[model samples]
Target: MNYTLHQLQVFLKISQTLSITRAAEELNLTQPAVSIQLRNLQDQFDIPLTEVIGRRLYLTDFGREIALAAEKVLNEAYAINHRTLAHKGLLYGKLKVSVVSTGKYVMPYFLTEFMRQHEGIELVMDVTNRQKVVDSVANNEVDFALVSILPPHLNVARLDLMPNKLYLVGAGPTGQLREEAEPELLKKLPLIYREAGSGTRQMMESFLAAHQIVVKKRLELTSNEAVKQALLAGLGYSVMPLIGLKSELLNNDLQILPMAGLPLQTVWMLIWPKDKQFSPVAQAYLAYIRDHKDAIVQQHFGWYERFL
Candidate 1:
């Protein structure tokens, strides 16, 4: 009936990945070591926690519940350690943030100096899709969430960090379309899209709908990198944030299409639930960002001003 915290951590990772090999790789443990830990953890529970079907591992319903509980336990344990450090007047803790996929490009630049200055602080940034990012915010799983589009239903406080400009971009040279081409010309070309719940996809749909322009949907990809790869392959055009395309644009591997109503605009914001309480690390981050965002933007993203 006695399971250690290490066992819980191992079980939680296994549940997340659903593969012993993958879990072992992530945890930097050997496969046999991970299996022994999992076995020991499973022995403490009477019911089945995981099962193997064919070649794949799957968590049982009971395993899923246990994993959630394990996460809560681990979070509290970490909180206690962080709290003790803070009481000692040290800026030490894990700073958790969930960012939309494309936001990875922006959030890291803002974080660099803060992280450098506070060497004791640890960062756990999850780069995920819009829906998951919003879910993390709603669940209060992270101190902040970085997004270009604000969730309409969430009552949250936000800090505007920088401008997020999206453009209809295609692969190869700039002469693909005339400067005065009608917006309706989009109908003739295929369009690559982010998955449905992505902020980029949502903005793309809203922009097209507003212009009453319906284009052909050629492909749907889950990550910005995948979408960019598709664009480079000449698969189709897509509405993409310029932050992620800076290198591509400079190299002339991609070009912005000329059309009216171009450069869909949104601001990058760091948002948290309005009612949530902050940790010492989170408060320090907020203060740092508030005081330094202007200077950080000027240093890191001043080139983006040309697109605005």
Candidate 2:
């Protein structure tokens, strides 16, 4: 705990390189100074951080723990500095967003357009399922989240953009999945499904649950693309976000199933923690989305409607 930032840096460098002389050279500090800093840290902790097993220094468990923590501290400090520069009209920062997997299918172009305008801002995107995206926001792993199906959680705040309509898509002998089929026949095909914790999957289940309809044959996949692939190969069929398989639907690679119980709906949202002081980068994305709210809804919903 008595380690200064410089001391932690030295400790990390030495732990990584396992050579005191090399780490000191890398830090442009004399070997003696680096040794002194390390000794001070060890004395403060009352433990040996590095051990001389033979000729090399190896990080003990405590040393590794401190090194990992040091990296977080340094990265967050850099993020704070970037945020400060951005808020002063510098408009330079890394915008990190966690998104639902289906959203990754369509949101990149919008993000790219923004990146072009604010060339100084970098984009970091993590595409995952809805639960993971929410967890990222609540745990501060990402600055914000773009979610298509907002889960029921009290810790996060969501901005309701629009309701997302689900589609039951497949590749089975189809002009359209429902072209010649009636409702009872439509449910007979292999039902490819999103994995548990998928907001879309939950919505689909809930919709069917209302009618006491449960898909007897269910094949679960992690991502929308994986579901599409499985459907195309005739492994199974799935209910999916329309964004994921638009080209497939148009090109007849897949077909939308026409069933009375299909095409369930869930709300699309942008969510973040309710912290008082979110980073400038996070705040900027929120502000940008708020300002361009209409344009975003029009774009995605318009695309969703096109296939209908």
Candidate 3:
């Protein structure tokens, strides 16, 4: 294409502000320079981009189409520049990670030291349910994903990060059931379930099935915080990752039911598409996890020993 990125940027700015003077001011260029760039871009396309009418400027149909293309082009160019910097041994890049809801509780601690060390790295973390995390991984939309249970369908490069233990917790009746009859806890208590697509919910289902326990569902919650709050309010008993309940557990606001086959243990993992190569930022973070995961987990979850 004859149109340069500089000219396209100038045109896009003009399209956004609808004023040559304003665009020039925002771009730190003279009005004449902005106009010249816009003119050059329009010339390359052989189309009139903007029209002045009644003291206002508006983009023509062709201009609007080109503006969309310009936006995509600029975004791709920005990504390329960041990639180039990363290849040059500069940590100036963005790292996008999709994490399951419960993983949110642990990922920040893992990221803190890494981020502190790499000042130029921009971290974008997407906290969602397990299914969406998997979708992002499948589509290669994110650099990595943090999840407890990996889906069996997708081929991924997996790294075990730490242990995630699921606890049966509640406020009132649920605890009484644990004390009253250990085996009947699952069958008798009103159970609050994480939504169907969640990894926690999947684990809960598997546990229930393996033990031939059928419980009454009291509620379905979408998030870890929501489930925790519900359990605290005596809404019902729910299975949750222990990492998310540190504060409440420490404060004794919620009780962990000491039932048989309790504290279901699973590994927290970092995964990326098998077909894609890891970026420097992703590689660095993965290496950090490999080197320091045990220390970090021990530091944050030292309280775990008291329960044992």
**Winner by lDDT:** 1
**How do the residues 202-242 of candidate 2 rate in per-residue lDDT, one tens digit apiece?**
87777666766656756788877788899998887666777
TM-scores, all candidates, are 0.78, 0.66, 0.71
**Model 1 agreement with the true structure over 177-269: per-residue lDDT tens digits:** 847466777788888989988889998999888879877789999989999999999998888999998888878898887778888899999
| Candidate 3 Cα misplacement greater than 4 A, ranges | 1-89, 172-180
List pairs with backbone clashes in candidate 3: none
| Residue 91 displacement in candidate 3 (angstroms) | 1.6
Candidate 2 lDDT (Cα, whole model)? 0.74
lDDT for each residue of candidate 3 in 24-86, tens digit (9 for 90 to 100): 988889999998998888778666888889989999998899888898998888888777877
Better of 2 and 3 by lDDT: 3
Lowest summed lDDT across 10 adjacent residues in model 3 is found at 172-181
Better of 2 and 3 by TM-score: 3
What are the lDDT scores of the predictions, listed in order?
0.90, 0.74, 0.84
Clashes of 1: 0
Let me know the TM-score candidate 1 reaches against the reference structure. 0.78
Q: Which ten residues in a row have the lowest lDDT in candidate 1?
A: 172-181
